[model samples]
Target: MALSSQTTALAQIPRVHIFPTAGEAADAVAEHLLATVKRNPKSVLGLATGQTPRHVYAKLVHAFREGKISFCDVETFNLDEYCGLTASHPDSFAAFMQRELFGLADFDPRKTNLINGDVQDVVAEARRYATRLKESGAVDVQLLGLGTNGHIGFNEPGSASDSHVRVVDLADETLSANQPSLIELTSVPERAITIGIADILHAREIVMLATGSAKAGAVRRSLREAPSTDCPASFLGTHQAVHWYLDNAAAAEIG
Candidate 1:
């Protein structure tokens, strides 16, 4: 298909909307998500953690407080978590999700699913989480945030395109960048458990949020690179329902 045709098809697959700034992008995405929940009260949502998604979570929280949306019947699965941290860890992805999203929404704790990073048999836990996703009929929509290195859900450089539910050592740059908040580079967990590229691809719809000039390079690569494991986010180009919600700064190179 032609490029415009392909973009149109992809938009139909989910919905891609670009905005002037991160806040606008977040607001638009939150509106769409709330509409989906209203239409299908039992929808399963895939959640992602990170600074990029902060505004989206804020908007969702505002809507909830204003009685504009309800998530009581929604089910959620978080994208990744640092492998060795407990849910209580300040820097853990679990805590991030709670502080940023779930705590703000009305979703029941029982309906939310996050990979148990503290599980003794990590491999088995990963498998069980994958199975639960399948049994729950997969995620109706998945929210995503891209790393500056082009990683998505901790699927780092050189990860297999088809890999699923696996443990991976965080890239050096990933650890270094997070050092400040995490106290030290050594304090950052070397490994993490994440949903596989395949699992993320299987979601019914995907909403990828990106912002800031810091993300410009990876955003460009994610849009321009050939679908390859070298840049995990490039695999998203192959996804039928992937929507890139980018701020102007992030989309500068693409434009």
Candidate 2:
């Protein structure tokens, strides 16, 4: 695929590390994340929430408990949140972060920010989140997970590569993908607030984790496809530095 003004050639892409198993990939990724954070002791991180990062969060929490990592100085912003849900809702992203990382990690609530999805003024909240990201400076490292559809954050198919923080309509697959275990797909929110492709490109570094056979096709397309709204993550090839960590299942279709 030809490179557009927005994307770099695939040959220039760097730092992809594939592993034999999901467990191995998670461990390596956690080491890279924690080690990078230890160097600064106070990094502004762009964090994504989902099943892919569950083990990585467990690693971080374990380190904090063992006195090997401290999050008191780390500032974090989540990539997206489901609309109409309060932070305390069991299915909310805020609650996921609380259950997955913060509660055990001693992360300061004052320094951790999550976009309020239930606010009446969702657009205003998105703009405010963008402002907070700018003030925090370039995210030291953004931890992301791929959707089976190749979307990043909530920038689904046809999302502009230059998109920024905004209110987004959830794709049909995205809604189903986020549906809780044993829960009806109709129960998931149809809208979300997400930091867009451009917002993530501003990060100092980007690390994306993809595991399982379900993500194999999307993972391959994300790297092989040229930068296009059709595959928003394909734009990552344009980034100066991006680390793609894939387990065997996710890397199955890729060379």
Candidate 3:
């Protein structure tokens, strides 16, 4: 299927664009996000991790230091985390977000929320997070990075479209590709804690960043596949406002 034909509302897909490199893509996305935050200083943001979003975060940090943006009035909620890891774990999503984004921007620790993988009562923690998001009046804009398996925010293959805050078994392929340095094929974690699809859709706008040749196939599938749980990122096309930013490498299969 063609990307434009994958969803019903192509007119509302926000804007899709391809840049020469990830850096150029990141700069464009960062500029828009920072402008939005500036317009509404108290904006609530949904954040994602992985290599694709690193350059975007770097640009945001630069904006922060250069007096172009401020996180003092911003509140952030992360997408997911490994089920059995602590915030301090080197490979933990929490640590990854801190090192890649929050720490660089000096965002207040209290204003940022990440799923606690170490929480003893997993269900309760998930519920509390959902409550927190609702209390914040939902996310204004969400940043996403697609997995090679077409998963988003840990919503892996077969993940229900209405799936909500909960823990799920990480698809072996997803884990292996995501953290190959720390997890081998056999040692990959079986479970992960992730925000639900409903939560992501609650955002007023969504921005997904994709980079590298490894992501080309998934990026193509996400933009062209039918809106089914099998291709999690495909659901974004159904969202009211979704923007996909891609580098040439990641957009290779677009045609």
Models 1 onward score TM values of 0.90, 0.92, 0.89
Give each model's clash number.
0, 0, 0
Instruction: Give the whole-model CA lDDT for all candidates, comma-separated.
Output: 0.82, 0.86, 0.82
Tens digit of lDDT per residue, candidate 2, span 1-255? 111232223324457777778987888789888988899889888899989999999999889989998889999999999888888887789988999998888789999989998899999999999999888888999999999998999999989878899999989998777775312235788899999999999899999999999999998888887888887889998998888888778877876
lDDT of 3 by residue, 38-64 (tens): 899988999987777878888899888
C-alpha root-mean-square deviation, each candidate: 4.1, 5.4, 4.5
lDDT of 2: 0.86
Local accuracy of candidate 1 as per-residue lDDT tens digits, 143-209: 9988889899999989888899888889997887667656223578888889999999899888888
Q: Which structure among the candidates has the greatest lDDT?
A: 2
lDDT of 1: 0.82
Residue 172 in candidate 2 has what lDDT?
91
* Residue 2's lDDT in candidate 3: 18
Q: Give the candidate number with the greatest TM-score.
A: 2
- Model 3 off-target regions past 4 Å? 1-14, 181-187
Q: Report the C-alpha displacement of residue 118, candidate 3, in angstroms.
A: 0.7
**Ranked candidates (TM-score, high to low):** 2, 1, 3
Position 254, candidate 1: lDDT: 71
